[model samples]
Structure formats: C-alpha cells, structure tokens
Target: MPKILPLFAKALTDSWRSTLGWAVGLTAACMLYLPLYPSIGGSAQMQDLINALPPEMTKALNYDQIASGPGYTQATMFGLLGFLLMSMASIGWGAAAVAGDEESGLLELTLAHSVTRAQVVLERALAMVVRIAFLSVLVFLVVLGLNGPSQLGIDVGHLTGAVLLFAALALFSGTAALFAGALTGRKMYAVAAGAAVAVLGYVFNAVGRQSPDVEWLLNLSPYHWAYGNSPVANGADWGAVAGLFGISAAFIVLGSLALRQRDVGV
Candidate 1:
C-alpha cells in the first residue's frame, strides 16, 4: 500500500474555506477588470488621459503602458489587483501554516501523532504550495478565457511566463512568512515578515524606476524580479524567475529545519 501525508491532508482540509474564498475572489477580480479593459483601453481619449497623468504616478503604479492590450492587462490585472489578491492569500496561508497553529496549540496536538516534526513542517509547506499553484492556474485560465474579448493581444507564451513569474513572486513572500513562523512560532511575527517583504519590495521597485542612482535597488526587490520588464508584454525573465523560486526553496528548507530543531508550543 502507498502512504499518505496526513499533515498535508489535514492542512488542506482545515483551510479549504479560506482557499475557496481566495480563489473566488481572484476570479471575480479578474472577470471584472478584464471586461472593463475594452471599454476604457480601446479609447484614444482614455489613452490621452492616462498619458496626461504625472509620470511619477504612472511609474509608481506600473501604468506606463496602459494604452495597449498586453500593457493594459499587465498594468491593471497582473500588476495591480492580481498582485494584491495573490500576495494577501499567500501571506495569510504562510502565517497560518505554522505560527497560527502553534499559537492555537494545534501544532502540539499534530506533533503528538506519529509524524515527525519535519513531516509536519514540510507537509504544511507543501499544502501552501498546492494552494498557491491552484490559484495561479485559476488566474491563468480566467485571463486566457477573457483574452480575446478584452482585446488583450498577449501571446500564449508570454502570458504563461507572466503567470508563472507572478506565482513565484507570491510564493516567495509566503515562504518568508513560513520561515519567520517556523523560527519564532509566532503568528504576528510571520505576518509582519511577509508584509515587510511584499511592501518593501514593491516600494523599492517603484522608487528605483524614478531615480537612476537608486535603480540598482531593483535588483534586491522581488517585485522587480517578477514584473520589472513587463512580462505580459515582454516575456519571462528566466533569471529573475529562477532567483525567486530559488530563494523560496531556500526559505522552505531553512524553515523546516528550524521547526524540527525547536520545541512546539513553547
């Protein structure tokens, strides 16, 4: 007979509602935004209006290319709303994976079973990966479904690259929270860590766009690694994608080790 990962199953079962809510919310956001793109984006007057906005404002919002199909999709859907939704979902799951369970005394109970501490941590992380992957695929399908109607001329290859990069970026933030939670066993700490990574990465990328002296800062920002070159219009930056995934994998390994070495519910 084959063995099942009980902790992974439990994690999914316990958090299915939150996962469903995030999926539904992401779908709704994608549907609403993509449908509106044609009406607003297809208008020359609207392009002029966007062009008239302050350069700093456009750069900050990654809105410099809202006049075209791929650009519109990137600026509104992937760069703005989709980014916000995925980040929130990933961060919440990461925090809850370890720190929330520990805080609630559930970690202790789960560990009292036959499972090793490594299994608990790794399974929880795996569950998070699965949930994030599901949401990413949902985003890809929703966007692809609306591509023609919305006049988004993004090639399938570029679209796939954008989706993959976006998912990796979100996972990186989640793993930051996961690492913090495993190290500290505190939910608040995990939340703070994840939020810090997301917010700082975004700010650095935005600011770097405005100043050449600070442009190098973008190298340190995950937001830049994901969307710096406008993956929706361009294509995947394979190096950046690799960096994001590598960093995330490193965090998971460190977090798992930390969890194994520490006492639960302490």
Candidate 2:
C-alpha cells in the first residue's frame, strides 16, 4: 500500500466515532424539524400567528420569511439548529486538533517522528476541513431526501448553495480556533476564540438586522456572509462564498506559520 500522510490519516481515524455521532445527531435534528414545516409554516393560521407577533421578535429570529418553504428550512434548520450543531462540532475538532493533542503530550510524540511542524499543522487543518465537509454533505443528503416529503420547495441549486455556505461558515469558526491554538498552544484559548467568533458574528448579524443605521455591522459578520441574502431562497452569492473560503485559507496559513515558530509541549 502507498504510504499516506500519517498525521492526517491518524486524525481522521481518531475522530471517526465523534464524527459519526455528529452526523447522526444532526441528521435526526433535520428530520425532526423539517417534517413539521407543512403543519406550521404552511398553515394559514400559523401565518396569522406569525404576523401577530412583534416585529422586533420576527426580525431577531429571522422569521420574516418563515411562511414559505425555503424560508422555513432556512429559519429552522440551516439558520438555527444546523448552525449550532456544525459550529460546536467544528470548533471542538479545530481546538482539539493541535492544542488538545499537545496538552495530552501526543503532539510531541508525533513531532518526534519524521513529521515537520508545518505538516502537522496543515494536516490537522485538512482533517478539520474533511470532517466539516463530511457533515455538510450528510446534511444536504438528509434535507434533499426530505425535500419532497416535507414540501420544503427549495431549489436543488439553491439548497446546494445554502449547504456550501453553511459549511464555509462553520469552517471559518473552526479555523479561528485552529489559529488560536497554533498561536497559544492552549485548547481553552482555542475554544474561547472559536466560540467568540460564532457568538459575535451572530450578535452582529442580529443587531444589524434591527435597524438601517446599524446594518453596517453585518459587514463584519460571517453569519451575514452566509445568510445575508437568504441563499436558500435567493441562490448562492459567489462573492460571499469566495470571501468565506479566502478568510478560512488565510487562517490556516497564518496558523501553520505560527505553529512552525513555536516549540511544542513547552
């Protein structure tokens, strides 16, 4: 057999169980929430109820488009639950990839072999990318399978755009954690950094939506980059997609360079 990149292979092998769990849990979440859209969002009574709710509440929760099929899926799954699940899983993996391993002294052992520090950082980052992509694909399949049954009415092309952008957003958070870990060699710091990115992005997007004056805040948010135009309904914004991928790539490069300069397990 050809010799593969050992670190990358090992990372994937070590993470299979947790990755599987995330896939299953997220799939279940999608199934549970999607099937109810017809009864709630598709109902005239529910539309009335939604209209009766305060405008502020609707804006904050992004329910402005909840009465439609694409809007319902965007609101319930991609916007809320899917975002939470993907962010948490990606952040944990990114932080643990380097900082967690170093803390446990496994990184030191790995580096003792023929692996260069740059390889270690880059390969770990690759593992994270793969895992996030895997989960995103799983989500797409689940949603696609239920699209007809649940009457989501999302365009196939648009749904693909939504999932890709969603995955990029999650990857962006994970890379933040990865960068923090490489810079500080501390898992706690990595986790904090990653969580901060997700939370602050969300807050900025939410507050920006509240008024025209503060809408500029959306320019600073990754959440805005992903759902600013409601990709599920409007289709993919390639510019925003490029921005996400660019930022993520930048993080990986910076993190790898920083890791190269640090002494592991010190």
Candidate 3:
C-alpha cells in the first residue's frame, strides 16, 4: 500500500465482509422482484390495483409507471429497495470512517502515524465510494441479465444512469454522515445526520409532488434530484448527478477541516 493510502486499504479490507453481505442482499432482491415483472407488469389486475391508489400515494410510492419495465425496476429495485440498502450501508461506512474509529481509539493511532489528517478524510471517502460502486455494478449486471427474460425493455444507457444516480444518492447520505462524524467525533450523531438527510429528502420529495404550490420543496430535495424524471426510463439528469458528487466532495473538504481542528480520541 502507498504510504498515504494505508488507511484507505485498511478501510476496504475491514469492510470487505460487510460489503459482500450487502451485495448478496442486492442480488437477491434483484432476482426476486425483477424476474416476477413479466407476470405482474402487464396484467389488467395490476393496472386496476395501481389506479385505485390515491394520486399522492401513486406519486410518493413512484408506482405511477409500475406498468412499464423501466418504471417497475426503478420503483422496486433502484429507487426503493436498492436505495434503502445502499443508504444504510453508506451511512454505516461513513460514520465508521471517522467517529466510529475515534470512539474505538483507532483513529488516534492512525493520526499518530505520518499520514496527514486530510489524507485520512479523503481516502476514507474514496473507500466508501469504491464499495458503493461495487454494489451498483452488481445491480447493473443482474438487472441486465434479467432484462430479456422479464421483458423490461430498459435501455442500457438509461439503466446505467439510474444506477449511477442511485449510487450518488447513497453517497450524498454517506458523506453527510462523514461530515457529521468529523465535526462531532460521535457515531450516534453521524448516524442521525445521515439518516436525517435521507428521511427529510424523502419527505420533501413526497410533499413536493402533492401540488405545484409546494413543489418548490422538490428543489430542496436530494431524492428528487436523484430520481426526478425517472432516470431509469430516461437518461440521467447529468446536472443532478454532478450536483450530488460535488456536494459529496464538499463534505470531504469540510470534514477534513473539522477533523483537523478537533482533538481525536479526546
């Protein structure tokens, strides 16, 4: 390992088992929901069931497009279940990157070495991204394999965009936790910060869909930014993708600055 990135290597090695578990969960979910789409996606009964849902419920659940292959995949796999799983994993990794380490007295030992604080922050963030990308790649491949059989008709390009957006959303929450962890050196606070961002973004997006009057709430929502316009059915909104990545980078900078100012393991 490079002298500057030993922490990064350690992060990945320590989390490999956890990452594998998450990948298994994602693969299982894909196998379960995606293969069933052919039977459930085209039925009159499914359409009637969806139509019976209230407008708010329809939009909030993202079930309005459930009849289509892309829509079904986005609602069940990428947007809902995948998003949930990735967010939790990312937050756990992010929080552990700093606060969890400090609380366990590992961070101070790393800092006592020659590696700078900034390197620790950036490399930790990079490790988190790598693990997330691994899971996302698995999701992409599994869905693509099932595409023909499930008759989803998903465009390869659009599906790529959706999966990337999903990863970015998870990064957003993860980086938020990282920032909080660096700022407070408290895992509980970091977890709450990460969870709060996801919860609030979800609520904001749901409310924003209620009416144009409050639709401005969507503008404030990272969830909307990630999933708006159905990136699975359509090409990704690159602007939103860039925005999420940019924010995550900012979290690294802010986190490094905060960690540098504080006393680790104090």
The predictions' CA RMSDs to the true structure, in order, are 1.2, 1.1, 1.2
**Cα lDDT of model 1 overall?**
0.90
**TM-score list, all predictions:** 0.97, 0.98, 0.97
Predictions in order: lDDT: 0.90, 0.92, 0.92
Relative to the true structure, candidate 1 reaches a TM of: 0.97
Q: Tens digits of per-residue lDDT for model 2 on 122-184?
A: 998999999999999999999999999999898999999999999999999999999999889
Worst 10 residues of 2 by lDDT: 1-10
What are the per-residue Cα lDDT tens digits for candidate 3 across 1-266? Answer: 44657888889999999999999999999999999887786777988988988978988988888899999998888878888899999999999999999999988878888888888998999999999999999999999999999999999999999888999999999999999999999999999999998888888988899899999999989999999889999879999999999999899899999998988888
Candidate 1: where are CA atoms >4 Å away? 1-3
Candidate 3: clashing pairs of residues: none
Better of 2 and 3 by TM-score: 2
Candidate 3: list runs displaced more than 4 Å.
1-4
Point to the candidate with the largest TM-score: 2
